[model samples]
Target: MTHLVMDVDTGIDDSLALLYLLGDSRAQLEAIVCTAGNVPARQVADNTLGWLALAGAGAIEVALGAEVPLSQPLQTTEDTHGPLGVGYAELPPHGRTISGRHAASVWSEAARSHPGEVTGLVTGPLTNLALAVQLDPELPQLLGRLVVMGGALNHPGNTRPTVEWNTAVDPDAAKIVFDRFAGLPAERRPILCPLDLTERIVMTSAHVERLAAASGCAAPERILPSDDRGRRSSADVELIRQLSDAIRFYMEFHRDMGQGFIAHMHDPFAAAVALDPGRAQYRPATLDVELAGRLTRGQIVADWPGPSGAGIWGRPPNADVAADTDPEAFFDALIERIAAVALDGPAR
Candidate 1:
């Protein structure tokens, strides 16, 4: 079994990542640390519990992470994730209580409990993990593996000309994570799924239709770009309905941004890689965050080896940056796995 602890901001994509893990039989999700990103941290906690209730996994502890970043005010993307951060889907209140422990402490505790067995997955801002690492410098070395969904290397930025959303939200934390994790054995380094590759893992209405069909939905779940912006799904299955509704908003947002009528499955893609590294290929590189740049404050700087086969900065590779992946293979597995879990229905 793969022991795991997840840190998320509970956006539409982050919710999908949670579902992916909840559905995957290989993942033993120990806890979920909710951070502020797509929405406020408290809202993130509520969104997470709601999803857990939907999955019938309410027993899993949900911890509230820091409400703000290390050095910047908290920033949320409600326009992208809807007002509640789960897009057009409004999950039924789970009525479950979130853990009283802070997310930083929860991280240290989970790492201590599982030690070399747990793998850390961060799908939102790096704020919580950065806090945990700051308090415990050895925290990075203790986990079996780490996977972060942030950064923009060799691709146009999603948040700005040179930055990704997650990193832009907390560049300091991103820097701390990259700097602290350097010098670890190659296998333990964090596998970063930057935009170059993640953007390719797109979700069109056809994929959603496949997922609904796989989930045994009797009614059609196909969402067309011509549909009303706030149209709610009426699929036979509740999970499938919500997924269609949520992803519709995301797909529309992508289209509005001129990326076509498709949703970029960034967080869930990272979650998939966390479960099966074979889903994507990676290359080790020395990574840094541009904190001082006027227009590149949150840009990720990946130092690839020069043509001479030597590092330009002379620093050892600190991260295994994702270099390639098959989007079709990933979606194929996701639809099957998520279908099984969605078929289980909600908890009573």
Candidate 2:
């Protein structure tokens, strides 16, 4: 079992990804820390704890990460995930309370305790990770690897033509993490699921339908309400069944927006890859975030001759850029794993 410490922003997708990871008996999820990005760090941490309770994962250690990036202002997509993040869907505001340890301290203690055996999956802004690195200079030395879900290397971004949500939220932190990891030796590799590569993959209608069917509940008259057009995306079928009402609310927005069924599952892709590298195809290249570019700020620079950058993880052109992922294989593995989660009746 791979031990993992996740830093997320508590978006609906983040909740789904955690549900999938913690549900898998094969995955030994050690800790989770919420960062400030799509939502404020405190809210993100609260959401994380709440979702864990919803999924019956209250035993997992949870911490509140930094409320802001080291040097940048925070940004959020309230319009996308909605203000509550769980989409105004009624969920218990109460959950198992986390320790007072901030994200960086929790990370430092974990790195010291584990020493080179723990892997980090960053599904939110890079602030907490950057801060942790600063707090524990030995963090990179003890880390197994870092998998990030941000940047726009070769593909266009959903937030804008050039920038993705995570990177845009904290480009400076992203740059620090990328550059710090770049100087590491071959034994340490940082995997990236930049927007360009992630855009090619989406949660299809079939995927969501599978989860709805597997839900073992009375299927709604229509999961996508007639009035909501955003949820009518081609990717609707991929919804993980046990998510909170906030997630359903976001789905309704998608359905209302006419792309509900086809909503793109972004952050969750990083978790999937961290679970298994073979699930996706990647090419190595020198990937650096351009924090100074006017038109392309927060864009990932992939210096490969081909359409997608090519390079090695520690060589001159280092870091693996996620070029392609086997959508069919990913979907198969996800559903199979979701089936394994034993929920204890409905959420309180």
Candidate 3:
């Protein structure tokens, strides 16, 4: 099994991504590191452990990392994820231990321990990654590859027309990771799931309902909503029905915002491609994150042909940029893997 070090911000989607990681049979999750994003870093750590316990995989270590981005103040979508950060999923308090070690240290230790066999699935802002590079310049040599879920290569953005939320959260940190990884030897492959393609993978009410029902098969607390308002009215059952409500609310929010009932599952695609690359349409291209542009800040500019040469960020990136995806096949694979893992229970 391939070892994976997952870094996330513990959003609702982040929770879904973790489900994929912990439940996926092919992945041997080494550790989970939390970062500040739609939630604070510490809360993200708590939320990470909470979800891990719900998945019956509380043995995995949860580490806290950067609470604030390097260049800008932290930004969160509390309206979307709830004040507690996880859409108020009503998860039970963690019985497992929370690691005191910082994200960078845990990342370094995991890399050193796993050597060139470890892959990083970064689903949050790139702050922890930048810190890791600072702690150990040798980290690049140790990682097998890094699968990042950020940037806006071909599609528009949700946060801003020119900026994706992850990169906009901390362009400097992203710049550091991209720059360092770009300089690494050919052995370290860095793959990016830009918002361009990720935005195309929509999670409809049907999908959410199916995921919630499937998750309920093995774990009652697994699919609880983040808010109480969106929960089911049935109080007779012990299962928490908040996630069902939150999905409804989120879908309504999307509809109100004119994004339709189906919003793209941004971070899950990153996790999906990380687990299976052949499932999508990938292209060999140099990617760059624009840090200087006013409106275009944090935008991902791919080295695909344009009338003006290399678009923006100028420097040639080194990675396989995701260009397209088989949406139906992608969701089907994700659902199958999730069901398989949840039914199989935790790795023995």
Per lDDT, the best of the predicted structures is 1
TM-score of 1: 0.97
What ranking of all candidate models by lDDT puts the best one first?
1, 3, 2
TM-score of decoy 3 = 0.87
lDDT per residue for candidate 2 within 91-174, as digits (tens), equals 465647877788888788887888777889999888888888888877887888788888776566766687888888888888
Give the range where candidate 3 is weakest over 10 consecutive residues by summed lDDT. Answer: 233-242
Error of 2 at 288 (Å): 1.4
TM-score to native of every candidate shown: 0.97, 0.86, 0.87
Q: Which ten residues in a row have the lowest lDDT in candidate 2?
A: 232-241
Candidate 1: stretches off by over 4 Å = 307-309, 345-348
Tens-digit per-residue lDDT, 92-211, candidate 3: 776777788899998999999999888999999999999999999989889888899988766778788967888889889988887788766544558888877887788775675565
Better of 2 and 3 by lDDT: 3
Clashes of each: 0, 47, 6
Q: Which of the predicted structures, 1 or 2, would earn the higher lDDT when compared with the native?
A: 1
